[model samples]
Target: MSRSLVIAPQWIGDAVMTQPLLRRLHARGERLTVGAVPWVAPVYRAMPQVEQVLEFPFQHGGLQWGARRRLGRELHGRFDTAYVLPNSLKSALLPFLASIPRRVGYLGEARVGLLTHRLKNPQDKPPMVAFYSALSGEREGLEQDRPVLRLDAREIDAALAAQGLRRGGYLVFAPGAEYGSSKRWPVEHYAALAASLQQPVLLLGSGKDTPVCEAIAAAAPNCRNLAGHTSLAQAFALIAAARAVVSNDSGLMHVAAAFGVPQVALFGSSSPLHTPPLNDAARVVWLKDDPGYQPPLDCAPCFARECPLGHHRCLRDVRPERVAGLVQGAVSSA
Candidate 1:
């Protein structure tokens, strides 16, 4: 079998969306190894198609040309092909440095010369699963590909045990959006929904999410704020075992989708059309489609970090009762 090196995307959601692409490559008789940063390494670990994951030490920005060169030297001639998932110029640099015979990626950031095979970025923002699957050189049926992920039962059990919980016994609420407040459903709304849920609500996120999760937990007695308290592996394990999940269009939302957990994904400044959770059990809530809503959102999908109009009505207008109904209905049916 030919060896293929997959350069993973930095964001957790994007990493999960790449699973379909990985599946395509794996189905074609390629032994896949993913190169990822520590933050998203566990995501690839959950993908059964990935043979191994090599954690890169590179930080967020700047080329770090010296570091890429050294790693490239170490990896020279070890792979038959390379798949660069991110469009950034830096993302494709390492493969070029390694002299990987075949590098596949999109035409991005003037990286025309870095890749041996390249696809044009779609004129329209397509579903993320389809966007990544194009890297496999298949253009048809892109929308039908759904990402799937698996976690060890023991790990899920361990994560629940540590939290004094059990599989399917609690709901996971991811209330923070790394992108900014624009995508987040209001904390007050989250608290109201958590209070109404029959099962315990476990709030999960990074350190940056601590404040919002804390406020939600404080407002609802059944909610436990675990933000910043659990490792990413622990977070994934918890989400995998959750009875259901309620989150913004963030990484954990995609995690739940990949695990096939029933989830309600709320979108505000973002559009679900582009990155909707690729799971049959997932329900997306974006007011952009609601025609009856007064003072309709014309600025929706602004894709801005902060709401340009200073009123996140796109999200805030979505009442807690609406989401509570979705969760309760799914939970009871489950």
Candidate 2:
């Protein structure tokens, strides 16, 4: 049996998108091992197709040479092929140092020699789902191939109980984006949406989102801010059991899609064409492209950390009423 090692992406959305590639590898009868950060490791662990998950302890953008060398030694000769996913030069160091004979990856950051079979990044930059899936050489079922995860029912129940929540009792809202505030919808809009839905809203995100979540909870009755309170595993369970999820273009949005949960995904600054949710159950509303949206075409998809122009109309113009309408439709159908 052949064994493969995959260097997982750092972002949750990217990690989730990689599932299709993993599935493709599994279909080829390869046993898979994934290297991922602590926060994103749960995703790989939840995949039944994955045989092992190795934790990458280095901080983001930090290159710890000694630690990487030691880890490389430990992983030496364990895999027949290693698919390096991240574009940074450091991302290839472990697999290269481990002496994995066949390393495949995109030619990134002058990493020409590190990978034996280097794939060129397409000029068009297709949707991330398609982009990652193509790396495995099976690109035909792009739309039909959704990220699938097996959640423990008991664990889901426990997560709900811990949050004083019950299955189908609330709407899940993820309002934070690690990318930047430009990608986040206004708190007022989220509050308005919560009030309109009449269902309790459970705000989900990392601890960084707590203040904003708390503000929204305060503005809307029956809303609870659980940001930073739950582990990634618990967050997955909560999202799996949600009545419906209304989320920004963030990692949890992809998590909701993985469960095939009905969701209203809000997008701004970033184009849905690049990193859209893969499941049919998701309704993506890209504000800049929506009807009645009149922002300068150039201003959109800046993909900037913060709007350089300082006017975040891409997100602000997408009214709560529009989002609420979508959520209501999704919930009713669900």
Best by TM-score: 1
Pairs in clash, predicted candidate 2: none
Residues 126-237 of candidate 1 have per-residue lDDT tens digits of 8889999989988778889988989899998899899889888889999999999999999899998987775698999999999999999899999999999999999999
Q: Please give each candidate's TM-score.
A: 0.98, 0.96
Query: Per-residue alpha-carbon lDDT of model 2 for 161-249, expressed as tens digits?
Result: 88788898888999999989988999999999999888888899999999999999999987888899989999999999998999889
**Weakest ten-residue segment in model 2 by summed lDDT:** 289-298
Model 2, C-alpha of 269: deviation from truth (Å):
0.2
Off by over 4 Å in 1: none
- After superposition, the stretches of candidate 2 with alpha carbons farther than 4 Å from their true spots are 295-298
Clashing pairs in 1: none
Instruction: Give lDDT: candidate 2, residue 87.
Output: 82
The lDDT of each candidate is 0.92, 0.88
Best by lDDT: 1
